[model samples]
Structures are given as structure tokens and as C-alpha cells.
Target: MPAIILDDISFSYSSSPLLDHVSLRVGDGERACLIGPNGCGKTTLLRIVTGRLLPDRGTVTCAGDAGPRLIPDTEGSGGSVGEYLDASLRPLRVLFTRFEEITARISEGGGDRLAREYDRLLAQMTARDVWSLDARVDETLAGLGLSELTGPGRGRSLGSLSPGQRGRLRLAATLLVRPETLILDEPTNHLDAGAVGFLARTVNHWHGPVLMASHDRAFIEDTATVTYDMDIDVWRALARAEGADEFTGLHRCAGNYSDYLEEKRRARARHSELHAAQQAEKRGLREHRQAGARIARGGVRLARAEGMAKKYFADRAAATATRRTRNDDRRLEDLSRQEVRKPRGYELSFPMNPVPVRPGSALSARRVAVRRRLASTSFDLARGEHLLVTGSNGAGKTTLLSWIATGKPPAGAQASGTIASDRPIGFVPQHLPRAGDPGFAEEIWLRGIGELGRGILHPSMWTVPVPELSAGNQRRAQLAMALAGRPPVLVIDEPTNYLDLDTMEALEEALHRWTGTLVVASHDRWLIDHWHGRGLHLEPA
Candidate 1:
């Protein structure tokens, strides 16, 4: 029997069906990935398989010695770690109840004292390891980089951790349970490069079956042994063979994502050509048949025949109109092809104003320290210059950006610095704010573009909402907002987090055109190599 199986599962939210009679089976120890565009029912299907949700039709079956274990949606269940664990172990409560019942029966007999002693012993046995629970919790926390997750020294609550950290914690919890099967949804959502790397390794080493849903192409390449493509028509199993490159494999005929996209374009082109030929042939046949019929009835000279001819002509015109409509549809389909580009970071620039030569320096830092490391650091950023800041995880890259923005150093650090610029400074941080903020999407974006003027806000901008905007558009909005002040310097941190290739190219072009000082912190190798900037490497202590 398969470890997990979905038999003719169908689900609908509202009038639209999300999963249309989809069926799939995953074998024990198999690692499969579910991939599709957003709102494609990947998450919904996962929920159904885990028993957290019931499908409108059909059933999900799990055949294993350990049975099924479902992980609830974090947002739906407001339960803490302890609460979740308790719920998971609820079956154990029945055994304890049975023990209590036995004790109750013994106490009713003549040997009341012995029954009381047995009751005491039973209670002690059941709770023998209760005191050590805290220790176990602490160990799990430490493994997830939450060493301070115990006692008064617990400086940060679980909620305070970054999304990446929270994801790690979830993984740790699952590992503790040692379940036979694991289902993950968008597991790489908030992870940085290093964290993603760590997770890739973890998944590769996992012994049990895994079914993950994600939009991150890179993560899917690294982790998925088999790929499942869910479409409106059917669920497909992509071919997987030896020596396959995750980015470009047999599941897809072309190669990587870009290659697959090109293939789609070619297919669309062929479809259009065939459709146009078919329409032309049908039109010709219809016209020929109409002319033949008119010739066959030519001898009729009555007024009724004239009227019938007019009606036949009208019907023929309507047939021609239908053919034209089909042709128009084919043409529209050809023109509507969407091109997929590779992921790339964005380029940002600030509006410039000529600044007089400063007597001292553009920027100076003296005796700077961050995170109990990078002791007594000092650096200067000159005008019209570019600098790259490099560091590992938790090396204070974000802390430095915060300090620059707020004019306050990180905890246990002090710095004296001066920033002089002729243009307004623009800064793009690593993480963007949540999309739930108020404003029509376009307005929020226009606001981000800042005071760069109405020219930057194109007429098409109004059509898209801010939260629904792509990563590149969001970065553009942030850039526009920063440039609104017209600062002379631009400070960017990890600017290319979720950008695609085209947007990154646009950013590079925009930056090349801008005449302002640039200060950036990034880990993108391509961006670092191509960008016309100096490097500032931050090594771990």
C-alpha cells in the first residue's frame, strides 16, 4: 500500500473547483513536490491528505504502522507548542482512564488499604518523566538556534523570531515527533540563502516520505526527487531519471524554468498557425457550398425564392462572422503568451543633487561595534562611490541598516559617523512589510516611489494592488519612496531577495543612469560581480 493516497479527490471553494477529481499516491520514503502557480490548490490538497480538511468527494487514505498525523495550519490554530503536543497525544489519555477505573474497582473491596497503595503507585508511574519535560523542550530549542528559550534568560519569545526562525522551529518539532510522513507548504517562504541551504541538506537527509508544496524553484530543484504537476485537466507525474539536474530535468522537455517557458512559446506559436489554417479552409468550404446551392436553384424566379436567397445570404454572413470570431480568438491566444524570466535582484538609485566638496569626509565611523563582535570598527564612504557589505547570517547586516536609518546603533554598540550627500538617500532593506497595509495597491506603490514625481507612476500602475504586486514591483515602490527625498546617497541591503531576471536588469540600468553615491549589502554573486562598486567584506568572529 502507498504511504499516502488520494482517490478521486475533488474540492471547491465557492463556485470554482480548485481540485477536479485529482488522484495521486506517494510510496514510502518517496520525496515528491507539488508545484503550480498561486491559488492552484496545492495547500488545499495537502490539508485534505492530512485529515485537517475533508474533500467534497472521495477519500484520502494513509496506510502505515504509525497511522496518520496532521499538522494544523499555523494561522487557523492559535495553539502554542505545548498545546499542540498535548492535542497530538490525546490518545494516551484513554489508557490513563482505564488505569483509574481499575483502581476504583479495587478500592471497593475489603483490601481498601492495598487498593489505595496501588492507586498511589499508578499515579507515580504515569507521571514519572513529567519533571524532565522542560529539559527536552530546551534541547529542541537549542537545536533551532533558540538557546535562550528557557527561564528568565529567554530574551525573545517564539513570536518575536523571524519567519525563517519560526520555520526552523516547526521543522524541529516535526523531527521530535519522528512521524512516518511529512507535508510542508511553502516551506521556503521567508528563508535567506544560508537557511535555504541548511534546509536543503536537512531534507536530503530525511529518511521518511515528504510531500512539499512550494513556489521557490531553487528549493524545488534541490529537494524534489519526483515532481507532480497539477493542471486543470489532470495530475501529471514528471519523468525522473538518473543524472538529472534539478533546474533542468526530464519531467519538463526543455531544461530549466526558462527553457520550459521557451518551449511553451513555441507550442503556442504552432497552435496559432494550425488554428488559422483550419479557419481559412472552413471559410472557403462554406463560400463554395453557398455558391453551389445558389446555382442549383437559379431557375426559380418567384418573389419567395428572392426572399429565400436573402435569408440564405444572411445565414452565410453569420457563418462568416462566426469564423472571424474564432480567428480573432486564435490571434488573441497567440498574443497573450506570458514569458517567464529567471529570478534576479533589483537595482535601486537615489535622486541626485550636486554636493559641494566636504572638507572632511562623506561618512566616517569610529570605534563601531555590533552584536558583541566587529569590535572597534571604523570605515568611511566617499561621495560618488560604491561599497559592498558582506557577512554570514546574524553578522549584523540588518542591524547596520537599521542604525543608518534610525541614527541609533544596535544593542551593546556605539558609533560616531557623519553622512553628507547632495541627493536624497534611498534604502531598500531585506524584508518588505506585510501586504495587509491600507491603500489601493497602486497608491501604496506610488507612495513608495516617493517624491520621484508623477512620471515614474505610469498609467498602468493603477491597475495592480500594492500587496499583490510582484517582488520587483514592491522593491521599485520602496526605491521610489526613498528617492522622493532626493538624497545624495543610496543604502541598500540584500536588494535582490525575490526579484526576477527582467526586473534585475531594469534595476541595473536605472542604477547605471543615476549619478549618486551607492552603499549596498548583498550576497548575490552575479550582482556583486557585475555592479560597479567597491567591496567591504564582513567576516564572522
Candidate 2:
């Protein structure tokens, strides 16, 4: 049975229609992904289906015997596990409280005997296995990697945990309830790659239906049996083939993302060719009347036949000559321009000194150790060099970047050292702050840049709010802000997170032109391969 269904759903925020009569259904145990460019309504659609936001028009229905039930959000509730569990099982809590009251009344006695009566009450509670509640809470906590949350007196607040940890805890609480349907929105955002993989595995093993909206391509590819690409194409063809509203099959490409792109290019080329052919036939039909008119006029008068024929032939010859001349002109122009100036790829390298003495190191680290959730490790970075830091999820790459930026020495530094240059430094963090009050954020960022007095700032940058800017533009703005400090060194973390291919390439070109020292932490293989720099490999200890 379908887990959830949307029939002719239409949603509009303000005057703009985000979804246009969209309809889709997810089946039991089906894993699906919703993908699209930013601002493409993926999140809005997810919210609508998850019942967080209501649709402007149309009906959303759920199948199976049980209908929709609200699942409580477990984060930042300032409630203990027991409290949450009790809230979830409110009817059971009420029944248990009634039983306790009845038992207390039955044990009513007098004097010192009342003390023994209290002990007897405690023994009765133990016999009734009331302590099992704590054990159950501990089990849930341990499963969610919150083993420290064990014990009734260990007053560990959920607020003390990081957002990622809280997110995990929320998922754990929901899973413990064993809901029939699950809807996750950008659940992987706060999770490391390892946690993402674990989530994918969990989804695959789940008996209930799963519907998720995510930007993480790997997670989608691993988990989704159906994918809805909003603002591009819906999977109606797959649904039709499956003989159901829900697609039961996964989209399997014979090769990688590049291969899929190549297939799309071929399909688009065929479509264009067919369109061009149809246009040519239409043009030929439109020109047919002129040719027939000339022929008819020539045939009507014999005296003018020879002259008309000559004129017709001359017209044809002139047209042919004109075509040839235009073709020749175009060919010559193409050849000339082809040889004129090809777009040169940027060449990035450290500035060379005339004397050519051994280039002094920009920064250096010796026997540096890093501590992360997954493991502990150490490494070194040399000056006048670029190093790619590569690792799997939970390998502490982000932590390392933070350590470098803060200038806090790494853990277990047997022979740790940091060499500083007179030049200033710039650091672009992985996550750009969300656009709230764009005017205020932009002004603050620009003022910081102005203080460095190192580079020219563009004036057009002020027009659009920071939130309105594209991801690539946001990263560029952050980079500009960092460079504004005129730091001799720059460290950028995950610079290509939301960037498209073209923007990613453009960023690489810009980075190549930069004269300052750079340290980049990224997972993009293309960025690593195109980078003309050394690499610092970190592994789990």
C-alpha cells in the first residue's frame, strides 16, 4: 500500500506558485529522494508532505489501516528521557499512577510500622520492575551514541550537545517509536559521512516507508529507489512503467554522474536536431510559393520565356553566389578568430624570487596531533606549499581546520611548531552563516575587508542581499572578506559544497591566481585533481 499520497497538490508562497498540480505517492518500505537546485521548492514540498506545512490546494492522503500521527520533536525540549517516554506513553503512565495509588492505600499503617510500610512499598516497586524504565532509557541513549546520558541522576542536558548530536538523538527517539512512515529533511546536513552511511544502511533495512529530501548525492544514490528532481523532471515514466503511482525501481546509470550527463547531452542533441529539421521543412514550404509564382509567370508568356528563364537562372545564380560568399566570409572569420586568442586556463603558482634561493617556507607544523570523535592523529604542514587534507567521515578534517584557524596547538605535539610570516592570514569556514539581515551581515563583512586595505572591493556587490546570492557567490563573498584582511596565508574549508560544475571551475581558476599561501580541506575529487599542490593525508588512529 502507498504510505503517503499527494493528489493534484498545489502550493504557493506569496504570489509565486512553487509546485504546480504536482502529484506523487511513496509506497511502503520505499526509499525516495527529492533533489533540485536551491530555491526549487524541494524543502517546501518536503514540508508539505511531512505535514509541517499545508498545501494551498489539493488532498494529501495516507494509506494502510493507521492514519497520520504527529511525532514529537525530541530536540531542545528540556525534558529527560523518562519524561519524554512518559509523554509518549501517557495512557500507560496514567494507568501505572492509578495502580501505585491503590497499592499505597492498601499498605496504610501506623507509627514505626509505617517506616517498614515505606520499605515494603519500595520493594513492591522493585517487584513491579519500575527500574526497567531507567534501563530502557539507557539502552536508547547507548544506541544513539549517548552512553554518557545513562543513569537517572546524570543531569546531562540535551542543550549541552551539538546540533549534530541533537539531530541524532531526535532520530533515535523517533526510531524507538517505530513509526510506519518517516520523513527526513536534510537529515544529513549535521551528520558526518560515517553517520550518513549508517543512515543509508538503516533506511535500506527499515520495514517502514522512507521519504527524504536531501542535497547529498551519495546518500541519495545509495538509499533512494525513486528520485523526484523538482524544477527539472518528475519520474512519471518510471511510475508508469511500474504500473503504480510509486516507483519501485532505482535509477541505475551504467557509469558515474559524468556518464549520466553525457547521456543527457546526447538526448538533448537529438531533440535539437529534430527541432531544426522541422523548422527547415517549415521554411521550405514558406518559400515554395515564391518559386511557383516565378515559374507560372514565365510559362504564361512565350516571348518572355527565354528572358524569364535567364532572369530565373540569374536569380538562382545570384542566390547561390551570395550563399557561397557568406559561407566563405564566415569560414574566414572563424579561422582568424580561432587563431586570434584562445581562452587561457589560469596558471597558479607561488611567486618566484629573482635570486632563486630555496623558497622560504610560509608555515610549518611538526608532529602535530589532532583529536576527533572517530580517532586521534598527527601530521605536518610546510610553508610555500599547498596541501590537500583528505579523510573519510568523522576523520576530524573540520576539527583540524578549526585548530589551524584558532592557532591552538594540536593534541600530543611531541615536536610541534608554527612558523608565522609578517603577512596577514585569511580563513573561510565551511558553513557560511545563513542570510538573515543581509544589510547588516554584508556591511559587517565589507567593513572587515576595508580594514585590511589589501584589495579593491566591487561596488555592485551591495545591490543584492547576501541571502539572495548563489552558493558560489556566497563563497566568493566569504573569500573576499577573508582576503580583505590581506593575510599572507588563506585557509578554505569545503569550498565547493553547493557549487555547480562551472562555478567550481571558476573558483579553481580564481584560487590559482591568488598569490597568498593556501590550505584547503575538501572532499571534491575534481578540486583535488586540478589543484597543483601537495597533500596532507589524515587517517583514523
Candidate 3:
């Protein structure tokens, strides 16, 4: 049996239905990925599978009575690192204690039942490698780059750690728990290259099923065995129905991210061809019907003319019109019943507004440093130049960017820096500040994203609360707000965090052509590989 199964699941947050009869399954040793644009119910479907939120319709079934376990992306509350680690190993500890008790009872020769229980406990311990549990825990922490926290930093409070560190810590604990079935939501969101590689390896070697929702293309390609695209439109489904594949909500593709792309491309080509042919047929039928009507009118006019010749001509014309009308009506009915749906098209062009600034140094910084957070650094950015910042987690990428854009150090940290900018600077950080009453969605509509934004964010979502919006949508809205002012110098940290491939590619194209100075910090391997810019590498202080 499959480890997890979702059949005909339907869910909605309001009148706007998010998921409609979506279904998927993951068997033992299979790794499945959910991919789509932002706010397309990837997270929502995962939530349903994990039992965090119940579906409004349909049912979720697991191989066993227990449901799948989720590896959360954030540590919810404050605690010492040591306490959190101990909590993760609590299940093994309890089992060990039970094993000891059973052994004692068997030694006392209590009964046959006690002996049987001892054997069962022994088997469980061996399978889980309880004797080497400590070593396994240590290895997991090291692999996820959490060794420092488990060593000298273990006594520190979790609140002192950066967001990335906290997320890594949570991932480490989940790995140690070794749940039978694993479900992850954007597991690579806060991971660096090394951590992401570690996760991919773990998932590749997993004994049970794994399901994840991720925007990391490289990771998905590396680990996914089957891909489930959750953002299918009815029109797209209709187009696919013209061929062998037919689905309403979820479209399943075999193999990894690359295979999925190729299949989608071919499907789109077929849809376009079919749509064009259908359109031509419809046009021809309409013309024939109009011609029939004209003939009928001519017959009426001829019948009014005086004489036997006119009467005979009117009869012939009327018969011909009647025959044509019947044929046109039959063909039109057939065409209507078998009509092809128009394929959904994407308009991916996002042209940047011209920056109004004199040609010179756009930004200049000297010996910028935040105490205990960032190492001293300096750079000169000219107009139309792009600068890419590369670093591992906790290497002060965010600190450097905040300082560059605002010339102010982070809270509780002192900084010494000399910075100047000739024009206005726009900054889009990884974590945005608390949104106000109008919310990010409403703000985006008010400030208008032109043609490109509409493609990513549908008009129905304009009234959704900012907090209710998906992470990717929030990021898109933040970007739109920043671009509305048209700053000559733009600084963005981890701009591709929650953006899907479509939006990411569009943003890359816009940035490539924009005539402005750019300072970008990102850990996305795909983006870094394709970036055409000067590089600045940072190390942890």
C-alpha cells in the first residue's frame, strides 16, 4: 500500500476554491514533489495530508493508522539548544526505558508473555540502531551544519540564533526523530548550498515515502521521482484532454523537474495546434451560415417579383437555402459539442521604468561593519552595474544589505561605515516588516504591476489579507511596491526566496536589461549560476 494517499480532496478558504478534487499518492521509497506558482495550494494540500487542516471533502488515507510526520520550517518558541535536542530524542529514550523494564521482567521469569515482549523490544531496538543513536544524532547535526549549536552553542537560547539557524535546528531534530513518513513544506527555504545538498542526499536515501513542496528547481530535480503540478487551470486541462492526458485540478508527471518541463512544453504545443485548427473550422461554419441566410433573403425577394420565371427561381433558391441551413445547423452543433479550449498564454515581459539619475557612481561604501555580525567590507557601484553577494547562512548577507541600503546597523548592534548614494535607493529584504491596514495585495493593485504582475498574481487575490497571502505572493507584492517609485539604486536580499520559476525567470530578465545599479544577495544556485555580474564573497565573522 502507498504510505500516503489523497483522493478527491477539495478545500476552500472562502468562496474562492483553492483545491478541486486533487489526488496524489506516494509509496514506500518514492519521493514526490509539488510544484506550481505562488498561492496555488501547494502548501494547502500538504497541510491536508499532514492532518493540520481537514479537507472540506474527500478523505486522506495512510498505510498505517498513524499519519505522516511534518518537518516544520521554523522553531516556534524559545528554548535552549540542548533542551530542543533532548526533546527530539525523547521517543528513543522512552523506548529504551521500556526495553530495560522488559529485560528485568524476563530475567525474573515472570511468564511467557514477558519473554515474548523482551524479544519484540529487542528487535525494535536493533532495527532503530538504538545503541548508536547518539552517533546518529551527532552525524545528523553535523550534516545539517548544526554542530556548533550542539557543541559550545548548545547552552545558548534559541532566540539568539538567526532565522536560518533556527530553521536548520528544526530540520536536524526532525532527521533525528526518523519518522516513518516524511512531509516537508519548502524545506530548502532557509538552507544554504551545503545544507540543501545534505537534505537532498537524505531524501534520496530515505526508506519510506517523502512528499515536499519546494520552489528550489535544483533540489527538486535532484530528489523528486514524481512531480505533481497543482496550478492547473480548467482551460489547460481541456487542452490536455485533447490528447491522452486528462485531469481537472492536479496534473501528474513522471520523473523530475526537467522531464516535467519538457512534457509541459510538448503539451502546450499540441494545444496551440489544436486550438488554431478549431478556430479555422468555427470561422468557416459561421461564414456558411451567413451565406445560407443571404440565400434565403434572395429567395423571398425573387418570390415577390412578377411572373412564372420569377416564381420558379424563388422556389429553387428557397430549396437551396433550406438545404444549406440544415447542413450549417448540423455542423455548428457538432462544432459546439467538440469545441477546443483556448490554451493559457503567459506574457512574461516586465520592462523596468527608466531611472532618472546622472551618470556617475551610484553607490560607494567604505569599511562597513556591524559589531559581531558582519566583517568589514567596501565596494563602489556605478550606474548600470550589477553586484552579486555570495555567502553561507549566518555570514551577514542580510546585515550587509540593510547597511548598504539604509546606512544603519541592525538593532542591538553597533556599526562603523561610510556610505553615499547619488539617487534614491530601494531595498527588498528577505523578511518584510508588518504590513498595515491596506495589506500587500491591495497595495499591489493600487500601485499597479502593469502586465507582468497580473500574470503571477490573479485579480481575485487583490482583496486577500497580506498575512493570508502565500510567501511567494508577499514577495512579489513587496517587489512591486519597491519598483513603483523607480529608484536608480536597488538593493535586494534573497529576492528569489518564495518566487516560482516563472516569476524568477521574468525578474532575471528585467534585472538583466534594467539601467540601474543593483546589489543582490542570494543563495539560489540557479540564479547564481546565470547571474552576469561582479561577485563579492562573504565569510562568517
Give per-residue lDDT, candidate 3, residue 506: 65
TM-scores for the candidates: 0.53, 0.58, 0.77
Q: Would you give me the overall lDDT of model 1? A: 0.56
> Considering every candidate listed, which one attains the maximal lDDT?
3
Write down the TM-score for model 3.
0.77
TM-score of 1: 0.53
- Number of clashing residue pairs in every model? 17, 6, 0
Q: Whose lDDT is higher: candidate 2's or candidate 3's?
A: 3
Q: For residue 248, what is the lDDT in candidate 3?
A: 60
Cα lDDT of all candidates, in order?
A: 0.56, 0.57, 0.76
Over 252-339, each residue of candidate 2 has an lDDT whose tens digit, in order, gives 2333334544544454454445445545644554455445445434344433557667677656655655555555455445433322
> What is the C-alpha lDDT profile of model 1 across 271-357, one tens digit per residue?
445446545655665576556445444334322446777667556655665665566556545433321222122234445555543
The C-alpha stretches of model 3 lying farther than 4 A from their native spots are 12-17, 52-57, 64-88, 94-127, 148-170, 234-246, 272-277, 299-316, 319-348, 352-385, 394-396, 399-426, 433-474, 485-489, 513-517
